[model samples]
Target: MTESVPPRSRPGPRRGLTERAILDAALRLVDAGGAEALSVRSVAAEMGVAPNALYTYFRTKADLVAALGDDLLGRLDLDAALGDADWRSAVVRLAADLRATLLAHPGVVPLLLHAGFAGPRALVAGEVLLELLSRGGLPADDTARASYLLQTYVLGTVALDAAELPPGAARPDDAARTAERRRALGGADPALLPRTAAAADVVAAYNGDAQFRWGLDRLLDGL
Candidate 1:
Protein backbone atom coordinates (compact mmCIF):
# COMPACT_ATOMS: atom_id res chain seq x y z
CA MET A 1 0.00 0.00 0.00
CA THR A 2 1.25 3.46 -0.89
CA GLU A 3 1.43 5.94 1.95
CA SER A 4 0.47 9.50 1.14
CA VAL A 5 3.08 12.13 1.78
CA PRO A 6 2.01 15.01 3.94
CA PRO A 7 1.40 18.33 2.25
CA ARG A 8 4.22 20.85 2.51
CA SER A 9 3.52 23.62 4.94
CA ARG A 10 2.88 27.08 3.48
CA PRO A 11 5.74 29.55 3.78
CA GLY A 12 5.41 31.84 6.75
CA PRO A 13 4.94 35.55 6.22
CA ARG A 14 8.22 37.33 5.62
CA ARG A 15 9.67 39.11 8.64
CA GLY A 16 12.32 41.77 8.25
CA LEU A 17 15.89 40.94 9.26
CA THR A 18 16.02 38.71 12.37
CA GLU A 19 18.60 37.28 14.71
CA ARG A 20 18.18 33.90 13.00
CA ALA A 21 18.76 35.52 9.62
CA ILE A 22 21.85 37.25 10.93
CA LEU A 23 23.26 33.98 12.26
CA ASP A 24 22.55 32.16 8.99
CA ALA A 25 24.32 34.86 7.04
CA ALA A 26 27.26 34.76 9.42
CA LEU A 27 27.62 31.00 9.03
CA ARG A 28 27.51 31.25 5.24
CA LEU A 29 30.26 33.86 5.34
CA VAL A 30 32.37 31.69 7.60
CA ASP A 31 31.88 28.66 5.36
CA ALA A 32 33.03 30.57 2.25
CA GLY A 33 35.92 32.23 4.05
CA GLY A 34 37.69 31.06 7.19
CA ALA A 35 37.00 32.35 10.69
CA GLU A 36 39.31 35.30 10.03
CA ALA A 37 36.86 36.55 7.40
CA LEU A 38 33.99 36.68 9.86
CA SER A 39 33.15 40.19 11.08
CA VAL A 40 30.07 42.23 11.94
CA ARG A 41 30.62 44.39 8.93
CA SER A 42 31.07 41.39 6.64
CA VAL A 43 27.98 39.64 7.91
CA ALA A 44 25.96 42.87 7.68
CA ALA A 45 27.12 43.32 4.11
CA GLU A 46 26.20 39.72 3.32
CA MET A 47 22.73 40.31 4.72
CA GLY A 48 22.33 43.51 2.68
CA VAL A 49 21.99 45.51 5.89
CA ALA A 50 24.10 48.29 7.33
CA PRO A 51 26.86 47.28 9.76
CA ASN A 52 25.05 49.06 12.59
CA ALA A 53 21.91 47.00 11.99
CA LEU A 54 23.62 43.85 13.28
CA TYR A 55 24.07 45.54 16.63
CA THR A 56 20.39 44.95 17.26
CA TYR A 57 21.04 41.20 17.20
CA PHE A 58 24.62 41.05 18.43
CA ARG A 59 26.38 43.86 20.21
CA THR A 60 29.85 42.71 19.17
CA LYS A 61 31.70 40.24 17.01
CA ALA A 62 32.37 38.07 20.07
CA ASP A 63 28.66 37.82 20.75
CA LEU A 64 27.99 36.77 17.17
CA VAL A 65 30.74 34.16 17.28
CA ALA A 66 29.34 32.79 20.53
CA ALA A 67 25.89 32.43 18.99
CA LEU A 68 27.42 30.66 15.93
CA GLY A 69 29.24 28.19 18.14
CA ASP A 70 26.09 27.47 20.09
CA ASP A 71 24.16 26.91 16.90
CA LEU A 72 26.74 24.45 15.56
CA LEU A 73 26.90 22.43 18.77
CA GLY A 74 23.13 22.38 19.07
CA ARG A 75 22.89 20.51 15.76
CA LEU A 76 24.28 17.30 17.22
CA ASP A 77 21.75 14.60 18.10
CA LEU A 78 23.31 13.13 21.20
CA ASP A 79 20.61 10.54 21.81
CA ALA A 80 20.57 9.31 18.25
CA ALA A 81 24.34 9.19 18.06
CA LEU A 82 24.64 7.10 21.22
CA GLY A 83 21.74 4.84 20.30
CA ASP A 84 21.68 1.50 22.24
CA ALA A 85 25.42 1.12 22.27
CA ASP A 86 27.29 0.15 25.42
CA TRP A 87 29.17 2.71 27.43
CA ARG A 88 32.49 2.15 25.70
CA SER A 89 30.95 2.10 22.25
CA ALA A 90 28.81 5.12 23.07
CA VAL A 91 31.81 7.13 24.21
CA VAL A 92 33.72 6.19 21.08
CA ARG A 93 30.77 7.13 18.91
CA LEU A 94 30.38 10.46 20.68
CA ALA A 95 34.04 11.31 20.19
CA ALA A 96 33.94 10.43 16.50
CA ASP A 97 30.65 12.27 16.01
CA LEU A 98 32.02 15.42 17.62
CA ARG A 99 35.08 15.27 15.39
CA ALA A 100 32.94 14.82 12.30
CA THR A 101 30.75 17.77 13.27
CA LEU A 102 33.68 20.10 13.84
CA LEU A 103 35.37 18.98 10.66
CA ALA A 104 32.25 19.91 8.73
CA HIS A 105 32.77 23.54 9.71
CA PRO A 106 36.54 23.86 9.88
CA GLY A 107 36.27 27.59 10.45
CA VAL A 108 34.54 27.01 13.76
CA VAL A 109 37.29 24.80 15.20
CA PRO A 110 39.31 27.78 16.41
CA LEU A 111 36.27 29.46 17.89
CA LEU A 112 35.50 26.28 19.82
CA LEU A 113 38.99 26.27 21.29
CA HIS A 114 39.29 30.01 22.00
CA ALA A 115 35.74 30.84 23.07
CA GLY A 116 35.57 27.85 25.43
CA PHE A 117 32.92 25.11 25.68
CA ALA A 118 30.54 27.06 27.92
CA GLY A 119 27.62 26.96 25.51
CA PRO A 120 24.43 25.15 26.51
CA ARG A 121 24.94 22.50 23.84
CA ALA A 122 28.54 21.92 24.87
CA LEU A 123 27.43 21.57 28.51
CA VAL A 124 24.85 18.99 27.51
CA ALA A 125 27.40 17.02 25.48
CA GLY A 126 29.75 17.03 28.47
CA GLU A 127 27.02 15.72 30.75
CA VAL A 128 26.18 12.92 28.34
CA LEU A 129 29.83 11.87 28.02
CA LEU A 130 30.26 11.89 31.78
CA GLU A 131 27.14 9.82 32.26
CA LEU A 132 28.42 7.23 29.80
CA LEU A 133 31.77 7.06 31.52
CA SER A 134 30.21 6.73 34.95
CA ARG A 135 27.95 3.95 33.72
CA GLY A 136 31.00 2.08 32.50
CA GLY A 137 31.92 1.60 36.20
CA LEU A 138 34.64 4.21 36.18
CA PRO A 139 35.18 5.94 39.52
CA ALA A 140 34.06 9.55 39.80
CA ASP A 141 37.60 10.86 39.61
CA ASP A 142 38.38 8.67 36.65
CA THR A 143 35.21 9.69 34.90
CA ALA A 144 36.09 13.37 35.25
CA ARG A 145 39.63 12.78 34.10
CA ALA A 146 38.53 10.63 31.18
CA SER A 147 36.03 13.23 30.07
CA TYR A 148 38.72 15.91 29.98
CA LEU A 149 41.14 13.63 28.20
CA LEU A 150 38.63 12.64 25.56
CA GLN A 151 37.57 16.24 24.93
CA THR A 152 41.16 17.43 24.73
CA TYR A 153 42.07 14.66 22.29
CA VAL A 154 39.13 15.41 20.02
CA LEU A 155 39.62 19.18 20.08
CA GLY A 156 43.36 19.04 19.47
CA THR A 157 42.96 16.56 16.64
CA VAL A 158 40.30 18.66 14.92
CA ALA A 159 42.21 21.89 15.42
CA LEU A 160 45.37 20.51 13.89
CA ASP A 161 43.46 18.92 11.03
CA ALA A 162 41.73 22.22 10.26
CA ALA A 163 44.88 24.32 10.34
CA GLU A 164 44.95 26.20 7.02
CA LEU A 165 47.75 26.28 4.50
CA PRO A 166 49.07 29.56 3.15
CA PRO A 167 47.36 31.09 0.13
CA GLY A 168 48.19 29.30 -3.15
CA ALA A 169 49.85 26.48 -1.24
CA ALA A 170 49.77 23.17 -3.07
CA ARG A 171 49.80 19.90 -1.16
CA PRO A 172 52.52 17.44 -2.12
CA ASP A 173 51.76 14.00 -3.48
CA ASP A 174 51.33 11.82 -0.41
CA ALA A 175 53.06 8.62 -1.59
CA ALA A 176 55.99 10.40 -3.21
CA ARG A 177 56.36 12.83 -0.30
CA THR A 178 56.24 10.05 2.28
CA ALA A 179 58.80 7.99 0.41
CA GLU A 180 61.10 10.97 -0.02
CA ARG A 181 60.85 11.98 3.64
CA ARG A 182 61.44 8.46 4.86
CA ARG A 183 64.46 8.02 2.55
CA ALA A 184 65.99 11.23 3.90
CA LEU A 185 65.43 10.14 7.49
CA GLY A 186 66.76 6.66 6.70
CA GLY A 187 69.97 8.21 5.36
CA ALA A 188 70.62 10.12 8.63
CA ASP A 189 73.72 9.02 10.63
CA PRO A 190 72.64 5.96 12.60
CA ALA A 191 75.01 6.75 15.48
CA LEU A 192 73.50 10.18 16.21
CA LEU A 193 69.78 9.25 16.00
CA PRO A 194 69.65 5.47 15.81
CA ARG A 195 66.11 5.16 17.17
CA THR A 196 64.61 7.84 14.86
CA ALA A 197 66.36 6.35 11.83
CA ALA A 198 65.12 2.89 12.76
CA ALA A 199 61.51 4.05 13.02
CA ALA A 200 61.55 6.29 9.97
CA ASP A 201 59.85 3.77 7.70
CA VAL A 202 56.88 3.23 10.08
CA VAL A 203 56.56 6.92 10.94
CA ALA A 204 56.33 7.94 7.29
CA ALA A 205 53.07 6.05 6.76
CA TYR A 206 50.60 8.67 8.03
CA ASN A 207 46.98 7.53 8.29
CA GLY A 208 44.88 10.04 10.16
CA ASP A 209 41.89 7.80 10.96
CA ALA A 210 44.10 4.90 11.97
CA GLN A 211 46.16 7.15 14.22
CA PHE A 212 43.02 8.58 15.85
CA ARG A 213 41.57 5.13 16.52
CA TRP A 214 44.90 3.90 17.85
CA GLY A 215 45.08 6.72 20.37
CA LEU A 216 41.40 6.38 21.28
CA ASP A 217 41.80 2.69 21.97
CA ARG A 218 44.86 3.31 24.11
CA LEU A 219 42.98 5.89 26.16
CA LEU A 220 40.01 3.55 26.53
CA ASP A 221 42.33 0.76 27.58
CA GLY A 222 43.72 2.96 30.33
CA LEU A 223 40.21 3.63 31.57
Candidate 2:
Protein backbone atom coordinates (compact mmCIF):
# COMPACT_ATOMS: atom_id res chain seq x y z
CA MET A 1 0.00 0.00 0.00
CA THR A 2 2.84 2.42 0.76
CA GLU A 3 4.51 1.50 -2.55
CA SER A 4 1.19 1.99 -4.37
CA VAL A 5 1.10 5.75 -3.65
CA PRO A 6 1.19 7.69 -6.86
CA PRO A 7 3.31 10.81 -7.43
CA ARG A 8 1.82 13.84 -5.70
CA SER A 9 -0.03 16.25 -8.00
CA ARG A 10 1.01 19.87 -8.22
CA PRO A 11 -0.81 22.27 -5.95
CA GLY A 12 -3.26 24.76 -7.51
CA PRO A 13 -2.59 28.49 -7.80
CA ARG A 14 -4.87 29.66 -5.00
CA ARG A 15 -2.29 30.12 -2.23
CA GLY A 16 -0.78 33.54 -1.38
CA LEU A 17 -3.76 35.20 -2.99
CA THR A 18 -5.68 38.05 -1.43
CA GLU A 19 -8.64 40.13 -2.56
CA ARG A 20 -6.25 43.04 -3.17
CA ALA A 21 -4.11 40.79 -5.37
CA ILE A 22 -7.14 39.82 -7.39
CA LEU A 23 -8.15 43.46 -7.77
CA ASP A 24 -4.66 44.42 -8.87
CA ALA A 25 -4.64 41.65 -11.49
CA ALA A 26 -8.06 42.68 -12.69
CA LEU A 27 -6.94 46.33 -12.80
CA ARG A 28 -4.03 45.36 -15.02
CA LEU A 29 -6.48 43.74 -17.41
CA VAL A 30 -8.53 46.95 -17.45
CA ASP A 31 -5.40 48.99 -18.10
CA ALA A 32 -4.62 46.79 -21.07
CA GLY A 33 -8.01 46.83 -22.75
CA GLY A 34 -10.42 49.06 -20.83
CA ALA A 35 -13.18 47.76 -18.56
CA GLU A 36 -14.65 45.53 -21.25
CA ALA A 37 -11.48 43.42 -21.05
CA LEU A 38 -12.36 42.32 -17.51
CA SER A 39 -13.91 38.91 -16.78
CA VAL A 40 -13.57 36.30 -14.05
CA ARG A 41 -11.89 33.88 -16.43
CA SER A 42 -9.59 36.56 -17.82
CA VAL A 43 -8.62 37.68 -14.33
CA ALA A 44 -8.01 34.05 -13.25
CA ALA A 45 -5.74 33.48 -16.21
CA GLU A 46 -4.11 36.79 -15.39
CA MET A 47 -3.34 35.43 -11.90
CA GLY A 48 -2.52 31.89 -13.13
CA VAL A 49 -5.38 30.50 -11.11
CA ALA A 50 -8.53 28.52 -11.77
CA PRO A 51 -11.55 30.68 -12.68
CA ASN A 52 -13.43 29.30 -9.69
CA ALA A 53 -10.67 30.52 -7.41
CA LEU A 54 -11.67 34.10 -8.21
CA TYR A 55 -15.14 33.31 -6.94
CA THR A 56 -13.64 32.88 -3.49
CA TYR A 57 -12.82 36.59 -3.44
CA PHE A 58 -15.51 38.03 -5.68
CA ARG A 59 -18.77 36.15 -6.00
CA THR A 60 -19.29 37.67 -9.43
CA LYS A 61 -17.61 39.86 -12.03
CA ALA A 62 -19.93 42.71 -11.04
CA ASP A 63 -18.50 42.58 -7.55
CA LEU A 64 -14.99 42.73 -9.01
CA VAL A 65 -15.86 45.75 -11.18
CA ALA A 66 -17.55 47.55 -8.33
CA ALA A 67 -14.53 46.97 -6.12
CA LEU A 68 -12.25 48.16 -8.88
CA GLY A 69 -14.11 51.48 -8.99
CA ASP A 70 -13.85 51.81 -5.25
CA ASP A 71 -10.14 51.04 -5.32
CA LEU A 72 -9.54 53.66 -7.98
CA LEU A 73 -11.48 56.40 -6.20
CA GLY A 74 -9.91 55.38 -2.91
CA ARG A 75 -6.52 56.37 -4.31
CA LEU A 76 -7.24 60.00 -3.42
CA ASP A 77 -5.08 61.34 -0.58
CA LEU A 78 -7.24 63.59 1.55
CA ASP A 79 -6.41 65.43 4.72
CA ALA A 80 -8.76 64.52 7.56
CA ALA A 81 -9.70 68.11 8.27
CA LEU A 82 -9.16 71.31 6.36
CA GLY A 83 -8.53 74.64 8.12
CA ASP A 84 -11.27 77.23 7.55
CA ALA A 85 -9.22 79.48 5.31
CA ASP A 86 -7.72 76.48 3.47
CA TRP A 87 -11.04 75.12 2.23
CA ARG A 88 -10.47 76.68 -1.18
CA SER A 89 -7.04 75.13 -1.54
CA ALA A 90 -8.33 71.84 -0.20
CA VAL A 91 -11.15 71.78 -2.73
CA VAL A 92 -8.77 72.57 -5.57
CA ARG A 93 -6.35 69.87 -4.47
CA LEU A 94 -9.06 67.27 -4.18
CA ALA A 95 -10.47 68.07 -7.63
CA ALA A 96 -7.00 68.04 -9.16
CA ASP A 97 -6.22 64.71 -7.57
CA LEU A 98 -9.46 63.20 -8.82
CA ARG A 99 -8.82 64.49 -12.34
CA ALA A 100 -5.24 63.25 -12.34
CA THR A 101 -6.25 59.81 -11.07
CA LEU A 102 -8.93 59.37 -13.73
CA LEU A 103 -6.67 60.57 -16.53
CA ALA A 104 -3.89 58.31 -15.33
CA HIS A 105 -6.21 55.31 -15.63
CA PRO A 106 -8.41 56.38 -18.51
CA GLY A 107 -9.31 52.77 -19.23
CA VAL A 108 -11.14 52.63 -15.91
CA VAL A 109 -13.01 55.86 -16.61
CA PRO A 110 -15.84 53.98 -18.27
CA LEU A 111 -16.55 52.09 -15.06
CA LEU A 112 -17.19 55.42 -13.33
CA LEU A 113 -19.27 56.65 -16.25
CA HIS A 114 -21.54 53.63 -16.07
CA ALA A 115 -21.65 52.90 -12.34
CA GLY A 116 -21.57 56.50 -11.05
CA PHE A 117 -19.93 56.27 -7.59
CA ALA A 118 -20.37 53.54 -4.97
CA GLY A 119 -18.64 51.59 -2.20
CA PRO A 120 -16.79 52.67 0.93
CA ARG A 121 -14.11 54.66 -0.82
CA ALA A 122 -16.67 56.85 -2.58
CA LEU A 123 -18.47 57.38 0.72
CA VAL A 124 -15.19 58.43 2.31
CA ALA A 125 -14.43 60.83 -0.51
CA GLY A 126 -17.98 62.19 -0.31
CA GLU A 127 -17.59 62.78 3.40
CA VAL A 128 -14.48 64.85 2.79
CA LEU A 129 -16.07 66.83 -0.05
CA LEU A 130 -19.16 67.57 2.06
CA GLU A 131 -16.97 68.79 4.89
CA LEU A 132 -15.03 71.05 2.53
CA LEU A 133 -18.24 72.41 1.01
CA SER A 134 -19.65 73.05 4.45
CA ARG A 135 -16.51 74.86 5.46
CA GLY A 136 -16.84 76.99 2.34
CA GLY A 137 -20.20 78.16 3.81
CA LEU A 138 -22.65 76.24 1.61
CA PRO A 139 -25.99 75.28 3.13
CA ALA A 140 -26.58 71.52 3.71
CA ASP A 141 -28.83 71.04 0.66
CA ASP A 142 -26.51 73.11 -1.55
CA THR A 143 -23.51 71.19 -0.24
CA ALA A 144 -25.09 67.96 -1.44
CA ARG A 145 -25.97 69.54 -4.77
CA ALA A 146 -22.47 70.94 -5.19
CA SER A 147 -20.91 67.57 -4.46
CA TYR A 148 -22.88 65.98 -7.28
CA LEU A 149 -21.99 68.86 -9.59
CA LEU A 150 -18.27 68.63 -8.83
CA GLN A 151 -18.21 64.85 -9.32
CA THR A 152 -20.13 65.12 -12.57
CA TYR A 153 -17.73 67.74 -13.90
CA VAL A 154 -14.63 65.71 -13.06
CA LEU A 155 -16.01 62.49 -14.57
CA GLY A 156 -17.31 64.24 -17.68
CA THR A 157 -14.04 66.07 -18.22
CA VAL A 158 -12.10 62.83 -17.93
CA ALA A 159 -14.43 61.11 -20.38
CA LEU A 160 -14.02 63.84 -22.97
CA ASP A 161 -10.26 64.04 -22.43
CA ALA A 162 -9.92 60.28 -22.87
CA ALA A 163 -12.06 60.35 -25.99
CA GLU A 164 -9.89 63.02 -27.57
CA LEU A 165 -6.59 61.27 -26.90
CA PRO A 166 -4.67 59.88 -29.92
CA PRO A 167 -5.16 56.12 -30.44
CA GLY A 168 -1.64 54.62 -30.39
CA ALA A 169 -2.24 54.49 -26.58
CA ALA A 170 -1.55 56.29 -23.25
CA ARG A 171 -0.48 59.55 -21.60
CA PRO A 172 -0.18 63.20 -22.55
CA ASP A 173 1.23 65.09 -25.54
CA ASP A 174 0.23 68.65 -24.80
CA ALA A 175 1.98 70.70 -27.50
CA ALA A 176 1.50 68.21 -30.31
CA ARG A 177 -2.07 67.43 -29.35
CA THR A 178 -2.82 71.11 -28.96
CA ALA A 179 -1.48 71.70 -32.46
CA GLU A 180 -3.61 68.86 -33.73
CA ARG A 181 -6.62 70.29 -31.93
CA ARG A 182 -6.04 73.59 -33.67
CA ARG A 183 -5.96 71.83 -37.04
CA ALA A 184 -9.12 69.93 -36.21
CA LEU A 185 -10.89 73.10 -35.23
CA GLY A 186 -9.60 75.08 -38.22
CA GLY A 187 -12.31 73.83 -40.53
CA ALA A 188 -15.10 75.54 -38.61
CA ASP A 189 -17.41 77.74 -40.69
CA PRO A 190 -16.22 81.21 -39.78
CA ALA A 191 -19.17 82.53 -41.73
CA LEU A 192 -21.56 81.08 -39.15
CA LEU A 193 -19.04 80.69 -36.33
CA PRO A 194 -17.69 84.23 -36.33
CA ARG A 195 -17.29 84.43 -32.58
CA THR A 196 -15.86 80.91 -32.37
CA ALA A 197 -13.49 81.68 -35.25
CA ALA A 198 -12.43 84.86 -33.52
CA ALA A 199 -11.58 82.85 -30.44
CA ALA A 200 -10.44 79.72 -32.25
CA ASP A 201 -6.90 80.14 -31.08
CA VAL A 202 -7.91 80.49 -27.46
CA VAL A 203 -10.46 77.69 -27.80
CA ALA A 204 -7.86 75.48 -29.43
CA ALA A 205 -5.52 75.90 -26.48
CA TYR A 206 -7.26 73.33 -24.32
CA ASN A 207 -5.12 72.70 -21.29
CA GLY A 208 -6.92 70.16 -19.12
CA ASP A 209 -5.18 70.89 -15.83
CA ALA A 210 -5.32 74.67 -16.01
CA GLN A 211 -8.84 74.59 -17.36
CA PHE A 212 -10.01 72.11 -14.74
CA ARG A 213 -8.62 74.24 -11.94
CA TRP A 214 -10.08 77.38 -13.46
CA GLY A 215 -13.51 75.78 -13.66
CA LEU A 216 -13.26 74.44 -10.14
CA ASP A 217 -12.51 77.91 -8.88
CA ARG A 218 -15.61 79.23 -10.63
CA LEU A 219 -17.78 76.49 -9.14
CA LEU A 220 -16.47 77.23 -5.66
CA ASP A 221 -17.00 80.94 -6.12
CA GLY A 222 -20.61 80.29 -7.09
CA LEU A 223 -21.16 77.99 -4.14
Candidate whose TM-score is highest: 2
Error of 1 at 215 (Å): 0.6
Candidate 1 local lDDT, 140-185, one digit each (tens) = 9999999999999988877876774332233344476567668767
Question: lDDT values of the candidates?
Answer: 0.77, 0.80
lDDT of 2 by residue, 1-223 (tens): 3668789985554778888899999888877787678889999999898888877678887788888888887788776335436887888888888888878877778766877678898899999999998887889999999999998888888898887644325866666666777898899899999998888777776665667677778987888
Which residue pairs in candidate 1 have backbone atoms (N, alpha carbon, C) closer than 3 angstroms, thus clashing? none
Q: What RMSD, rounded to one decimal, does every model reach?
A: 10.3, 4.0
Runs in model 2 with CA error above 4 Å? 1-13, 80-85, 165-168
Q: Give the residue spans of candidate 1 off by over 4 A.
A: 1-16, 164-207
Best by lDDT: 2
Error of 2 at 21 (Å): 1.6
| TM-score of candidate 1 relative to the true fold | 0.76
